[model samples]
Target: MIKLKRNDKIGLVFFLAFIISMSLVWLFEERFDQEQWRSNPGKRYKMAKNIIEQDLLDNKSKEEVIQILGEPVTAEFSDNNILIYQLGTPPSFFDEEPQELIIVLKDSKVIHVSVNQEE
Candidate 1:
């Protein structure tokens, strides 16, 4: 059997590294594709609108909001009168700022649903 020379060993190492990298990339291709890397302001706004107009806010409990919009990334309760739910990625070049959905409740019913889009 022939032993590998110094250059041959270096080349073999580089080849192995490349193969490993390619294999990892191939294995994770589907996950990479599923990630949302670009901003779709319109789609996010539409989802927020649907959440508001579809009477999703009729249920006043936090669990109801989760059922309607999946789990919110952020939630706030102030004085039991105001509720804020924020969703999506934080402000960035690749994604619009998190969208805030404010629900004003009266008598355990939604009195107003406000959709705010960050600039």
Candidate 2:
């Protein structure tokens, strides 16, 4: 076996630690769940990434969206062809605004989906 210098050993340990920690994070990352979404609003941010990446809401009908995500936070936004589901405040050290899952619709079908901070 090759012997590493002290500094090289330290660097190797740190690199291995980073790889392990990142793997743990990926393993624990949340996936979208309808029940969890309706029950735990605060955890929506964890699942939002999955939804967008999978295009889960894309091209779905308005009623289908409601069935999947429950009702929008308010009806006022619906008039403008947008559905907003409050995702609660994201986990952050900085003062971050609450986020929302914005689903845009056209002709009563979903056209786009995104997670955006509430203004």
Candidate 3:
């Protein structure tokens, strides 16, 4: 039979709490990862681009972009109000670069779309 000392019991409680909190964090993180904003080379982003082109959503209002693409991963820049869609490719897992779909906006309208590959 094993009995925990007072300090040992306190330490064990803290340890258990820590482990449970961490597990909860891990679970929620997995849920958050599945959110649309997490930059992936999946068909969703492709469909987003296609929406911009086919629906002529490009050159439209910011609301239009949001309606099509959902919330951006980052802010629209202050200077040019550049809306950046950061994308990652599974095939480029070894590559440390992230592909960017940069939507340059002026007067709350998309003016240019640049596809940049970060190196």
* Cα lDDT tens digits for candidate 3, 17-100: 999999997665422123454444453333334434554456788878766666666665566487766555424557645566
Clashing pairs in 3: none
lDDT, model 3, position 71: 64
Identify the runs in model 3 with alpha carbons over 4 angstroms from their true place.
1-55, 90-96
Residue 11 deviation, candidate 3, in Å?
82
Candidate 3 lDDT at 92 equals 53
What global local distance difference test value does model 3 have?
0.61
Q: How many residue-pair clashes does candidate 2 contain?
A: 0
After the best TM-score superposition of candidate 3, give how far the Cα of residue 90 lies from its true spot, in angstroms.
5.5
Where is model 1 poorest over a 10-residue stretch in terms of lDDT? Answer: 30-39
**TM-score, prediction 2:** 0.76
Q: Which ranges of candidate 2 are over 4 A from the true structure?
A: 1-22, 76-80
Give per-model TM-scores: 0.41, 0.76, 0.49
lDDT of 2 at 30: 85
| Model 1 root-mean-square deviation | 14.1
Cα-based lDDT at residue 22, candidate 1: 100
TM-score winner among the candidates?
2
Residue 4 of candidate 1: its Cα lDDT?
98
